[model samples]
Target: MHPLSLRSARLRLVAVAAAVLATLAAGLTGAAGAQAAQGCEVDYHVQHQWPGGFTANVTVHNLGDPIDGWDVEWDWPEAQRVAHGWNAAFTATGDRVNAEHLSYNKAIATGGSVSFGFNGTWAGVNRDPFAFRLNGRTCDGTVGEPTTTPTTPPPTGGESAMDQVAAMQPGWNVGNTLDALGGETAWGNPLITEELLAHVKSQGFNSIRLPVTWEEYMGPGPGYAVDPARMDRVEQVVDWALEQDLQVLLNVHHDSWMWLNELGTDHDAVLAKYEALWTQIADRFKDHPAELAFESVNEPQFTGAEGAAGDALTEELNLVFHEIVRGSGGGNDDRLLVLPTLVTNADQPRLDALKATIDGLDDPMVAATIHFYGFWPFSVNIAGFTSYDAEVEADLVGTFQRVHDTFVDAGVPVIMGEWAVLNYDHNRPGVHQSGELLKFFEAVGFHARDKGVTTMLWDAGQFLNRATLHWRDQHMYEYFASGVTTRSGTASFDSVYLPSTGAITAKSLTLHRNGLEFQGLWHGGTRLAEGADYTVSGDTLTFTAAALTRLAGNRAYGVNATVEARFSAGVPWRVKVVTADAPVLSSATGPSASFAIPTQFKGDTLATMEAKYADGTNAGTATWTSYQEFWSNFRPDYAAGTLVLTPEFLAAVTDGQPVTLTFHFYSGATASYTITESGGTVTGTA
Candidate 1:
């Protein structure tokens, strides 16, 4: 989604009413003094209620610096007793309630939050609790007044708005094809048809986030009329989605014309176009059912050199969009409008900025939306391989956590407007590749559900084959349909590529206790004929002497294979193996360092250099262009760019000390140079 900057571990996971009730904790509600510090903020949402029962979601945010742990206490103005809670230990004494962070959630980094919810019984009235205290400190800021839960039933509107949003099924974005740079077919995907919508629905996605750009379809100046034909096309798509019983979110996407620094250059003109655009859109959809929503903008950015000034301007523009839409009359008054952050970034700062900018806005139906493509190395299916590592889990949780703390905890609903991991060859031999993918989705989905944040999967015909009207990856489809709780023990091998000849044995294959041992080997999606193509012994698969030759004899992308095993249940295991070859720098080279390229960059052309000092200071950088220059000046010295110690950088190098130089290759392969400086010369090894 081209979020301006993802920053770092900038998110936290939140639990929504759907899953909140499932994780209720049983404990004593702690007590705190009125003098408790004022940094903690709480948002108590009564998600659903019955004759004598109700469910509530509470988020406790640490607004100050990082804290090792946190405790939140509150007194119910109404008679309410906690039944159970999740993510924290909870207790209720009379009308007072208290909660403490769980082991994993104890250390809340500054501006981060943890959430918990519970089911309770209220005899007289079911009102929200206020005057919350964190770690013996009173929460000072006024977040928002509680809104009554909607009266709609199970499938729609019978619960709180948050609950209804939480109930939204997995979503899919009809990406690049519809949100194509030029037009629907510009991106090589066929025009949108009802069949595609039905197929998507059949796959279990109940919501669709249509990314559309209106600038190209609009006329010039004042009344920036979105062309009638384009409007019809959009309406047609929306109608198709609605017909499929899918909730649709439509936005003024990539409208750089009016959204790009309009607040700084021609404020009134930009505002006029924005309002004019929304005026038409709001009026057009005013009669549409509540299933359709309007997003003000997509990835709004102000790069006119004004910096934060542009952010302020964009914020003002968002306010205008909200006002115009709400004032458009009809159902517009109750329509849900999503406000994108300055750059639609999910980083803590951007989220905080968004929260601050939209503060005090009277629209309770509005949600703050942001796109997440964080930790591309793992989250993205680059090179058809990615890690579901601890780092990825940590980053995902931290990033979502901040979003929950900043907006969701403040009474503003948050939406992960776009998120997805490409569908690749997830059927690797030993590791549960499909299972891992499901876990990733489930992790994000569960947190999103718990936080009342809806996630829309971004699909630009990457995972789904639009022309064929089928999913390119059925495992991914199954995972989405089955939800995260479904158990599977699918495993992927350490490597799927076999050499021209010889045995390709999987090393240290992670085995589940009582799990079914390796039963068969499949190559190119076909089970290799037993004893002819390969032989299996214990955990090893020995390709017969000529198996590799026969498999890849004429294949273009080479042959792929996976070893299969079955397990009664799912279990977590860690099996470490040295996979990628580290780049080597020849010590013989002086001033210029030569490198042994990793396998990932075997035939790739470009390379980029990123340098930094010991203290994390920028040293210098060179883009892909420098790769050619390096080779032209010094031919065939290993591969790609050879870092030549120029006087500028040499001067900064301390004698006999090491400076880290990172090289980024075009193939997503990365290596580092541990260079040591000696008098008048530089030499290093990677």
Candidate 2:
């Protein structure tokens, strides 16, 4: 008989659960008894007719009193077999159907419930609401009705926080931790809040790629004590995500490896310390459903500082991962584990070394991760130097796609652990630069959604309007937080699995209500709409739904009668052009539009100005000796003068630099001048 059978029948009863299902165990068969049986949860209710060929709908409830999780188990004779399952995640074999972990068992409120199900056929007969066993223990009583709706359905098992991360594709690097997440030390930063957490959630960002300082979390001794406060802070943030119904991944971050980059050192002692750290974390959050995951190390590039030949280090780290995962007190045996590259860079040489598995931990949850920071110049392209040129910008995006395709094709999950704007502080010359940045990001966001690659943005700190912190500028980084924050009623986003083919245009996108709101006029370059013609029905803006017509000159062009829509007030506001049913990051990716600026500012020309509440031709102009100086004072100052460029007869300041000091001359005695910059600023995250 099976080892689990004796525990269920006359041998002894510990915890009871629904019928059993055997899960796959292709790797690691032996381990200490304490860590022998895998962990799981049970159901309080079951829905089905008496056994044979009947489908069993089990509600996997974390009913361990004031509970976070429960492990439900039951033994099945070889004569019976499980056919299918749903709601809660499940895995079964010829003699067992085990479900000890509940996917939907979120903060199972005092007496709240989450249900799951499975269909199986007993060779002879079976009973409904069968007695269940949990973790080799038996439940005190039988399961309730599978159809009884205490509230919601059970969580699908095997699901982890990394699942949602499979959205942000093609990652980048964080350079130094201080420059990351707008934090100080690479160690800690401002506390996590609902809004900051939501910001990351909306940007289609999936992972945190946290670079933890291990020496910081480790205490003296083999205990490898991960600080409770720090851990709590990390877990608290994860908790916020779980609240948003998102995923949270935790890793050994960048600490230990940054200083002690080596992999071999009395592997036993090291593994034990790793074990201790996980034991504490796992025990506390083990039942956080499966949304929480563990990553081995950040950028464990062995061989001193940073070198490619040190990849053999990842192999040893893999050993540590397997040993700790299967060791005593580590409930992470079946949990998802993210493995990084030699240097964690997605660039070619480093990516080539990722062909090997963790030797033993090649389970489905074992995913591959790397970073990507394409075309640095684009982010720091101050003087419009290498900027502009849409094709070049799009080319960089292609590079991102190439790297993503390479890893995804490998079958294992690929995560762009770190990615962001080249310069978090872009202070210059770049057209289509903003659009280029967003265009590629959006394209990749769409592609990542299309494929199943999980992604994580750098972190969230310099990006939110927390409001509590004091500021010298008064406005705070709120400008960065504006459109990026995930507000209520915004566009619902997720990786769109639905597939469609053809030339299509997303039209008349609007944002109104508590959802996405607009603050600028449409910038012409982006061409988010079909053309300059369009109609609006409330907030769901629609564009020229007409079919595209191909033209000559090696260009595929289509004529869209309607092009843009302004999000003024009243109704639903749109944030993006997405395919239906696709999961969208709750981001405020506003339409390509601009808000009016004062005449003192440059960029905006009279042709683009719209009278807020006026009639006739209202204009503002300025006259200065030098174009450069003119631009300096190019703001609105309610002055009655002629818009002149003080032609200077090429006589004064004769510098070949061609400094034309032109000034905007306001016509109608200070017509409340408005400046409409040619380029609309790009800021916002989900």
Highest lDDT scorer: 1
TM-score of each: 0.54, 0.45
Give the RMSD in angstroms, all C-alphas superposed, for model 1: 20.3
| Per-residue lDDT of model 1, residues 600-676, tens digit only | 33322223345555876554322222221222221122333233445554555566766676655322456666666
> What RMSD does each model have against the real structure?
20.3, 18.1
lDDT of 2 by residue, 1-686 (tens): 00111111222224322232121121222333323233224443323322123335454433333444544455564455554343333455445456544334533443455555554544334533344554343444332212111122234555543443442222212233422332434333444567654444332233344444445556867667767776776666667665544455666655445443544544466556665765666666656655566777676655353544466667566556655654534346566677787767666666666655543445666777766554543443322222234554565556556556665665566776765555442111221133234433443444454556555555333333234433222211211122122122222221111112455453343333342343222322233433333344565434444412111112211111211222222111222222221112222222223221223221111111112212232222212211122211222222321222122221222222222222222111122322222123222222
Ten contiguous residues with the weakest lDDT in model 1: 1-10
Best by TM-score: 1
TM-score of model 1 vs. true structure: 0.54
In candidate 2, which residue ranges exceed 4 Å CA deviation?
1-155, 159-189, 194-211, 221-224, 262-288, 302-308, 328-330, 358-361, 382-405, 426-433, 468-686
